[model samples]
Target: MTSTYDQLVEIVTKLHNPPADLIRPDVTFAQLDVDSLTLVEISLRIEGDLGIRIEDNELEEDLTLAATTQLIDAKLAQ
Candidate 1:
């Protein structure tokens, strides 16, 4: 099974099409030039694809992919 981080990377890639090298765990969405609209879209995709609802306000461009994965994992645990 694909991990949450891998799922998130796929979501971001499908939405933003960022370079593969830049999709590392340490890279923030801001670094990939993801805007507010794209972030909202990403959140929607996450909900649909992962069955986890991430509030729009909870997603910050400063959040790294790893951090987002942790957030989703925490939510799933709940």
Candidate 2:
């Protein structure tokens, strides 16, 4: 199975098509130019694809991909 971080990268790639290097773990969604609406879409995709629901408020643009992966992993562990 793909790791949570990899899965998130795939979802973001499908949604935004950003440069590969910009999708690093340290990068925030804001750095990728992801706005509020897109963040909601990304959150929905993550929930659908990963089977873990994350609130919109929890997915701030400042949150890094690594942090998002951790959040998902924590939820999955629950």
Candidate 3:
């Protein structure tokens, strides 16, 4: 199955300036130097990639990759 983690990793790889070869689920956005603007871009990219729309308020700044993946998973499940 195309799990949320997989999707998140794909997006991070595509969007990251330096781009990570592998994205750990536990990694934090701050570690990547992803600011609010980047996160907003990521949100848009996710919707475009997954064909699902997420509210802006739904995303938290402290959202770990793992947590974001979980949130996506839940949204996809719904």
Per-candidate RMSD, Å: 0.6, 0.6, 2.0
Candidate 1 structure quality by residue, lDDT tens digits, 1-78: 999998999899999999887879999999999999999999999999988899988999999999999999999999
Structural similarity to truth (TM-score) of each candidate: 0.97, 0.96, 0.82
Q: Which stretches of candidate 3 lie over 4 Å from their true place?
A: 18-22
- Residue-pair clashes per prediction, in order, are 0, 0, 0
Q: lDDT of each prediction vs. the true structure?
A: 0.94, 0.93, 0.78
Screening candidate 2 with a backbone cut-off below 3 angstroms (N, C-alpha, C), the clashing residue pairs are: none
For candidate 2, lDDT tens digit of each residue in 1-78? 999999999999999899887879999999999889889999999889889899988999999999999999999999
What would you estimate as the lDDT of candidate 2?
0.93
What is the descending TM-score order? 1, 2, 3
Q: What is the TM-score (0 to 1) of candidate 1? A: 0.97
